[model samples]
Target: MRINVNQTQCGFVMKNGCYEKMIFAGTYHYPACMGYKVIIEEMRGRVGFKEVPLKVLKEDAAFMSRVTMVEVPEGQLGILYINHAASAVVTDREAAYWNVWEPCELRFIDMREPVMDRNVEKNLLRLIAQQYYKKIEILPGEMGLLYQDNILTDELGPGTYYYWLYARDVLCRIVDLKMKELEISGQEILTADRVGIRLNLTATYRIADPKRLVETIKGVENQLYTRIQLIVREYVGRYRLDEILEQKEAISGFLAQRMREEQEQYCVEVQTIGIKDIILPGEIRDIMNTVLIAEKRAQANVITRREEVASTRSLLNTAKLMDENKTLYKLKELECLERICTQVGNISVAGSGTLIQQLRELMGT
Candidate 1:
């Protein structure tokens, strides 16, 4: 029988004027009025394709050609057509698909439940092959790797390799539920205009169990941020305003330690917690300044009083020592005579050495 091929319609017309569409099956030559009858007989014993409609095959070129005519093997779905150009192959497994014709386009549609796993790497590569340029947001419970373009090659240099790994969206969310409960209690200890004073807190987390994350903590990023804010607020509140304001470094250290302990369940690593600022209330700060000034003034008064008392005691002790020493009395008399001699050129003695003795007798000494 004569058959007319139409690329536009993707169909064939027999000499009897009956039209049959190209389907996903091995080439078959059929007799007039028996369109696709040979192909139907060939697929009769197959499991998945046994009763498959011929019309369905014509619409899906990739599925028709790429899939095996035999039943689909366990653990693998029948190939699905993505593009009409017959370039790409999509599978139900892992929401993954690839473009063998283009050999560059790939895509991983996130139609399945969230999962954190290594399969993300495979899915990412597939997405890149599909030529999708978009940021794949991984929630708190989701973790996976995604390649940008189909640039994954062994010939890539070290710099390019590093870039690919860094570019991958492999973040995870670690929540602090305890901190949230505390916040709801409204018992904040350290109330600052800001949180985590002087501490630089950075968290590094990867999807340890992608499936678990997707199922349990599906939207983790927002939750993690909320937990962090709460944790900082609660822990900071535990300290006094003075501690936060003056001991920022100490506060930061404590926060880092606390965060590490709290975030362990999410398989997160708190790389570092840095204290950045210690915010203080204006009123409390003013009171502290006043108290400090008053304390300094009191200390100065005490020192001044002690010095005055010491000086007076020292003068009185020196006077008592002078009065008790008989040798000091004689020395004083000699000093008086030397002073008189210096003032006058010479001192006249009434009776030689006995002058002072005669004066003492005259004075009834």
Candidate 2:
């Protein structure tokens, strides 16, 4: 007997009750007079019960030139192929060939486990993503919120996530988890002493709970900013101008304490709060400068007057001592005469006979 198969077909032959191994397309001649059993199976990409071909094919078997083929791309789930003859699942960029003898069904599933949005997978069988893939992009030191149908579901941190698109009707909200600053500048407030002052404040904060952030709090940044501003006003409003200027550190501490108490409610934590500046009114500043200068000048004048009085009192005591003691009076007179003699460059008496006696007489007079 002889059998022929085309290149498009694979054949299995059973001879003498011993089933032969799987064979490919070709022609084979076997000895006659021996019992010959033949089974021809078609490789169709389908899953079902397939009937076996019993008739022994000589040269009359149909030849197929092309076969059905299915391919699965990388990063994709198993590809399911089924028909009336066979069923299979292929994984990881696999290529499969099936006979065209029957109808074949082919399907590719994503291994990412996201099937809620078919549109997302439709555009990307490999690396390319579709537009329907709602993106939750959180930069480093950032937090993200995932919501499905208006309900908060998951909190994400610092990475690109397909969860927003993988699930159906999901929405994403991103919050800055890094430290951020808020400023309140040129705020005109009235102190307890009825002084009008301009207060400038700065605050730094970061998000703590991303999941409860959107659900429990609204406008977290703005809310925190307003809280700081209000706290500043309250603290500064209670103190006088002098206290506010001198006790800026205390005011900052007060604000921080308030934020600490209320931070958890807003899902944010305050790193620091400070008074950038405490600006007085133009007239108040000029008055303060003038008063400071006048007070300092008064203190200097008092010191000068005290020193002069001390010197004059000391001179009076020395004069009293000289008057009471004759010896001291004589010595002081002699000292004055010595100072006078040194002032004159030359002292030449015309009558050189008794210069010392004449000088003594003049001194006595």
User: Each candidate's TM vs. the true structure?
Assistant: 0.34, 0.54
lDDT tens string, model 1, 1-365? 43343322123323344333433323345665554332221221121332334454446655445333323333222333334322334452322232323222333334222222344445344423322222344334323333233322222111111122222332322223221211122223434543322333443444344334444565655665566666776777666565566777776677667767866555445545654434335676677799999999999999999999999999888668769996876676667666765898754557665887875654346
Among all candidates shown, the one with the greatest lDDT: 2
Model 2, 86-186: lDDT tens digits are 24455435343454655555565553443234443433423333533455678998777776767777777787666424335777788777888888788
Q: Give the whole-model CA lDDT for all candidates, comma-separated.
A: 0.45, 0.68
RMSD of each: 16.4, 12.7
